[model samples]
Target: MIAKLQIQLNTALYLRDPQSTDLGQKIVQEGIYMIDEIGFESFTFKKLSKRINSTEASIYRYFENKHRLLVYLIAWYWNYVEYKITFETHNISNAEEKLKIAIQLITSKLADDDNFPGISESVLQRIVISESDKTYLTKNVDQINREGLFKGYKSLCMTIASYMLEINPAFKFSRSLTSTCLEAAHQQIFFAEHLPRLTDIKKEEKMYDRNCEFLTSLIFSSLKS
Candidate 1:
């Protein structure tokens, strides 16, 4: 069932902009593939263009530079996750259920067979860990609270935090904890992939499920505490 859903999701994403198809999406996808195969430092637009059957000029038409393209790809993943969660669990009444559903959605998407096949574990780690720094340096801001990718992430965190507050008004932590939970999950997933020897579990699905369980437990425990 999960495999089938993943296939459908990938097909839908590929078919999203049939009319006036922007060649940029192909460039971005190839760039992501190159980053997955080689580290970001080793990745170049020339290599990406060669892989995508396009010229450097065509790639630049979509992105100013490789850095901006990376940021956009990361933002794209975040937006995709947000859209899936909003669609799947938006109407659930119980905050606890909503939280669980959110975790499940994330894990399922990450573990999906049709997920961005070229993205490597290290690239994902870099994106999650360096999101704040990247955004700050790129935008020359102290923090990201307004618009764009960071704002989208912030909105998701606040939405989850609000649901948590509804479940337990006494829960004192700010919405930042939601962000922390997200980071923790990303770290766990990365660790499971890149450092499996250090981890007891070997299976990606097990690691994903464990992380989801831990995150859900943390939220619910905090509510009770």
Candidate 2:
């Protein structure tokens, strides 16, 4: 049997823990679907409340505003990914193979897992790829960063960077390389679907496989250089 997983996020990201209560869980579960369906800009408390048959005030009880909620969602995604990376690489003794697994996890397609009942990873991944950048691009980013809101993302990068350093002890830009590849993976995926001209991935080909191949090549080449 697949074990259920809980992704603990920073407290500052939300007013109340959305995973704590039934109503709160509904907020997160429905919020993910609503944001993915209508997008973050069009997403509002009124819409979310109506979808969940709750009041806007009730939704606000769990989250400060839509932006905070978005950050919470993004942060949750990073934490989940980090957990996967840790679990998938825990037994591997080979550094190169471990790094390869991390790359594939980052670049591959996401699907709904029964282990996480309320959250749809496949749908959340779409929000992550498309709307995640909006969370930290605001002017108050420094304030939120001070609150440890970006810890999950930073932790994920650090985990991947560790693998890089394991493979090449002398590599100087492990963190930089990890962050760049992470962003590049998201950008390439977005470009392939929306701005095809911006990426080399063909529409007819398997996107995840092609993307994983490209990233593995890039990471190994850079580490070897």
Candidate 3:
């Protein structure tokens, strides 16, 4: 069992910090569960308020809107991912091995961690796989980014990109490569379940195992060039 995880995100993500109060935490916990149960396109704060038995006004106090709430949840997940990566790889001195460990952490099947009793990491992982793109695929992305809405994602990506450089100092496009690895980890699992035609993984092989193999080959091959 993982110990209690305390990930502090940027204050800009919320109007009222959810971790500061019980009602606020309920909004976040239920929001994650509902978004995963339904889909982001159909999620609303009204529905979320109903789930937590709080008025819409109460939820609005915590978040400007459900979109910000979603961003908050996504940010928290990325923070958790960074925490896991550090925990799993910090002791390893080998860059190749560190990169491999990082890939494994990102691609592995997510299991619930009791440490975070509010949000279900397993369910949140599903939301990330499906709804994460929505967080940035908007016309106001620049404005949102200017407000540091994507700091969590960007921070984690930079950490991984740094690992990429450790493995291949001469290789350019480390950031692109790092981002691609993150996207591929989510996209391939999504494609395997919903759009099998897009991926080459065999039916008998677990998606995580296949991705680990493919990414290992891809990362190593690129570094050798």
Q: Give the alpha-carbon lDDT of every model.
A: 0.60, 0.91, 0.87
| Top-lDDT candidate index | 2
TM-score: model 2 vs. ground truth? 0.97
Candidate 1 backbone collisions, by pair? none
TM-score of each: 0.74, 0.97, 0.95
Model 3: worst 10 consecutive residues (lDDT sum): 199-208
By TM-score, is 2 or 3 better?
A: 2
* Residue lDDT tens for model 1, 1-225: 223122111111222321123575467555656776686678788988888787988777666667656555555556556776787776788877887787776554253224444334345544554342354465534332232435556666787778788888877884866877866666666667776675543555477678777787777877788
For model 3 the local lDDT of residue 178 reads: 82
Tens digit of lDDT per residue, candidate 2, span 87-143?
998999999999999999998888887888989999999999899999889999999
| Model 2 lDDT-worst window of ten | 200-209
Residue 13 of model 3: what lDDT? 94
After superposition, candidate 3 runs with Cα above 4 Å error: 1-3, 202-205
